[model samples]
Target chain A: MAAVVEASRGERDNQDQELVQRALTRDPAAVAALVRRMAPVVHVRVARALSRRRVEARGRDLRADMEDMVQEVFAALFESDGRALRAWHPERGLSLENFVGLLAEREVVSILRSGRRNPWTEDPTLDTTLNELDTDQQSSAEGRVASRQRLDQLMDRLRERLSPLGLHYFRLLFVEERGVAEVAEETSSTTDALYAWRSRLGRLVKQLARELDDEEEVSDE
Target chain B: MSEDLPIRVAQRLREEDEALDPRLERLAMGALSPEALAELEADAARDPELARQVALFRPLSSELQDRLTEQMSAPVAKVIRPARWTRWGLPIVTLAAAALLLMTLRGPSALPSYAGRVEGGDVVLRGEPTPAAQGRRVMRGDSLLTLELSPATQVDGAVVARAYVRTPAGARAAPGVPEVDPSGAVRLRGVARELLGVASGTVSVALVVARPGALPEPDAAFAPSEGPRLEVQLLLR
Candidate 1:
């Protein structure tokens, strides 16, 4: 089974690399294909970006605005010999979809910020250090690996504190990443109740994080 | 401290622990201070468990984003209709309606009555409360002689008794402390203009007793039936 999965992954990587090369060469069909595949995800990401900033579309045509943002993302990806597309190293074993989604999200957020009538004047969701971590350029790969290990240990401790309901909530919300409405309908609960549960779960995780941090500082001293 | 978080988030968490929403929101938006994000990254880098937590919560940021996006994308139906009434016209129409209602409420025959015995000469309908007997000219707003009864009726095994008056308008309980003395006395004073109307009519006064296991509705007693009763004759010319 493992070998089959590995073989499939290899085939997908080859396909992705070929598409990327074709797109970089400015093949019209290749570019169109990429756009078709990326548009929905890009539109979703852009909408998410603006919302996190609390940018109100107000009475404006939001669909048009989203289309405009998606266009801009495509334009950037294909500009100047498709530098961004070439820069993406699928050999790094990262999901190419996630990389493109993140790129599109960042580009959309930048466009929204620079928009002439942009409602948001601040980057409310910007965490520059995490942003730096995302690039993985500011820290050694080994350091990131070690940090991830420490994070796992802390999570195990938190898991112990969570009740069955809490665990179920985390699984549904985070692990499954299902929509709140969908989850609420499935569980026979109100969306408001689901939001409340999520808020509570977040607090529990943050509290546990704080306690873990305190213990680490004590040990370091 | 809870106030620092979004109202929805604070609604579900303890005051001390309610900042998670803003923290996560800021984290997702990349809005946290460089120092704080760096510290968080360092912590995650050093702790594998924390890294897993970070991984778990990474999707939550997107979940929130998707939720907000979905909300924004929902189509809002705007209904545009022609104005039914002008701004000034609305108030005038309202005032006229209110005036008509007031007239209907305060017109003659809006008076209420109470249950009591009507002796032959007890109720006198004149222009005012007077010693006039039997028949008298009654107009709108004229007071009638008070109704007085003596041993109007007796019921067996009646634990409680309630008296109500039936008028042309409606039936209402007599306005006084319920007193069924050993002599069984109930009296009521009313105006003919209010109870009988300006157009000369008769009103019926009835008493109902609630027997054990058979409690009579006070309003139901006002309906003429087989029960303790007194017939009062009022001739308003």
Candidate 2:
């Protein structure tokens, strides 16, 4: 019985390692499996938080509503063809949770920007949205090999730090693709307030990644 | 930083990003300091997340290149927009003039988008014309012509061109901490051509005169220069 149990345990470890390897190779099947398993966690977290926001807004066009923002996040992540899913590279601090959080933060920022004009007094017409576009981002072939390795290591570290609650938030925001208003209405908060919370939570996730990077850096040194 | 870009290009990026839905242009010069560009390049190759971020920047860069090509297009200069007063006469004159050389706006409202060295002459494109009914006018010195834009007007080329304005950029924005901005000297650095690619055209003209408005100082976003006073032309899809 002991020998049989050992064999089973060894097999399980092998399976886990194989999954990790597949993910690193940017395999679509592996990526889809991972997304299916984790997307819901993101949805639940976003939904619960957004519900709180919906209650807070008595009725105001607050920019960066979580629910409104979440859908775009999933769409961008999953995209139409799903090319980006397989391309996800792990960085020192880019945990799956953190990656989702980064997407959330970026989405919110864009949302906030979409509605808000440049806040300059003198130049009311001054387009505040400067050159946000950086052209031609293809990396040189020379550095890609090392960069890919480093990125994979980073993703591994990032996935490990994701908490269940954080995972849920990602699923809510990324998978369910809920609007901030909808989330706020459910949670009894305003979209504006939800924006603040989303920002804060996203910040926390980044802090965790930073800590992870520090750990990795130390190990490397 | 990235490679050195033309002055018109720098100006356009400073002025237009989301407005002109552009494709990616791998920034070659000046947008990023060489060291920073190198550092980021290294990061991108190794970092998938970073790579994704880098990819996001492509469309914008491509737009810049396209704008430059449009700005420097000799072919466009040779073709002229037909004038309302005469049948084919206006276009032929403009095209003839342009094929010989790109019109130089002697006064303000000239093609101001070109960098390095540009000639002086004006192509007055004023008043509201019918949608897609192209017209061209020779620069009449002081009276800057305005191309009253019709929805979905795609006016390109010099002879067929209504007006050309190139606003030279000077100054720079603080590094990092992006803000919604157009005409940011810092961000633009030294753009050579800012092609105005307009989509779902509105009453806004693809090319317009800056009038007598004074440009801002080096520190100011709107500082004016004494040279040609053309604006960044808007191109339509």
Candidate 3:
């Protein structure tokens, strides 16, 4: 069964390569075909990314925003003489669909980051952690020890709150840091199901963080 | 410290999952040989980022694949049937001919069109006089410009208007978000010099009206067939 799936994937990759070559030569049919094939994949990923944002959609229709963003993703691909599309390397094992999905995810992230008014208030700890990750070399030994202790405490609380399956998911998605598709396949779950789990996990983490903050405030007092 | 620790750790770990690498994709797809896979796994153990990437690679679902294939089955454009016009072709041709005849008999239909001209720093209806125009040249020394558009015919559906300025440098979309009045007229205000850019030659401003989602690219050449369009040329001194 695994072999059959791999064979099918390989065939599709070949067809995608042919279509891409035709698209690069200014073939209108190829361009339209490529857009039609990839739009839904791009749409799904963009929707997922937008769902993860803390900011409200600001009374704008999210479906419409997704559609426009999907168009922007295609425009980026086909623009500049299809420079981004040409960069896809199937020979190296990256499929066109996955490549486009990755691009869409990155674009949505960039858009959300740019539109952020106040980064600290939105998700301060996580934002600070990401910033620190970028400048890890500057951290003092004391800071590192405190950070490690906090991480261990958080992990213990998470283990108590989450079910075994949920903990496994957290391990795969956060600790191991796998892709949604990859994680879904390993868990024998659908992408939609995995996304739901992710959202639930995010909410749980935020709630726990707040509780921890309250405890610290009481201790400080 | 403990309260925020869990969320921050999770986020940092997730953030460490870098962009998809082709070799990592191969590992996920089971394309790598056993030895290669072991070597990659060993390397990933040493590198947290690589471990995250290797874990992240996976193929799209069969449902998505089916959707893509279904969409690709349809042709991008309607097939022109000049060579093979045998069965359904004659009827299609007759229907097209009848539609053309009806259009010709009805004369030009009342598709909405716009008329615009510069009055001092303001773009208004062609016949309207601006107070600034009486004292100064229309296109000179104006820091800001107002563009006003009104449909010449009754609009049946939602109409959208976009404005562009063409200069020796090239064409660019005029600044300012368009405001639509209840009467189906549209108005935009932008800086005159900025709209014209730094080019010191003939400048043309175009106002295009179309149904929602039908506007052409800002830099694309104006096609009347696309929608009702109006252009006014100004010679800069």
Deviation of model 3 at A11, angstroms:
3.0
What is the per-residue lDDT of model 2 for residues A1-221, given as tens digits with 9 covering 90 to 100? Answer: 00011112223234334443453343433333333322333333333233222323323322223323444444444443433333333321233444555444343333333444211123322122111111223345324533333332333232344433333343344335567677666545678966665555455445544665688689899
Give the per-residue lDDT digits (tens) of candidate 3, residues A1-221: 00001112444567677778776664444544565446656765665554333123323444445544555566556656667788776654456876777667656554544444222224344445446564765567546645644554455456556643566677677677788899888666888998888778877876766777788899899
Q: Give the per-residue lDDT of model 1 (tens digit) for A99-155.
A: 576667556645654545343334333344345456766457646644543444334
Which candidate wins on DockQ?
3
Task: List TM-score per model, in order.
Answer: 0.27, 0.19, 0.30
Give the DockQ (2 decimals) of all models. Answer: 0.01, 0.01, 0.04
Candidate scoring better on lDDT of 2 and 3: 3
> Candidate 2 chain B: worst 10 consecutive residues by lDDT?
B178-187
Task: Give the CAPRI class of candidate 1.
Answer: incorrect
Error of 1 at A102 (Å): 0.7
State candidate 1's TM-score.
Answer: 0.27
**Stretches > 4 Å off in candidate 2:** A1-32, A44-56, A59-69, A80-88, A116-221, B1-237
Task: Supply fnat for every model shown.
Answer: 0.00, 0.00, 0.05
Q: Write the per-residue lDDT of candidate 3 for residues B1-237, one digit (tens) a residue.
A: 244444577764454334334355344332344465678888889996566444433223333322332223334332121211112345445644775676577654444544332333433234334322222223553344544454443344456777777776677776535555322456554445544453345676666666677676877634335455555555444
Candidate 3 interface RMSD, angstroms, 1 decimal: 22.0
Ranked by TM-score, the better of candidates 1 and 2 is: 1
Better of 1 and 2 by lDDT: 1
Off by over 4 Å in 3: A1-7, A115-221, B1-237
Q: Write the per-residue lDDT of candidate 1 for residues B1-237, one digit (tens) a residue.
A: 132222222222222123233333334333344465677778889976444333322322322222222222223232121111112345445644764676577642211122222312222344533322223322333433333332312211223345455556776664322333222233333344333233356544444433334435656654554434433444454
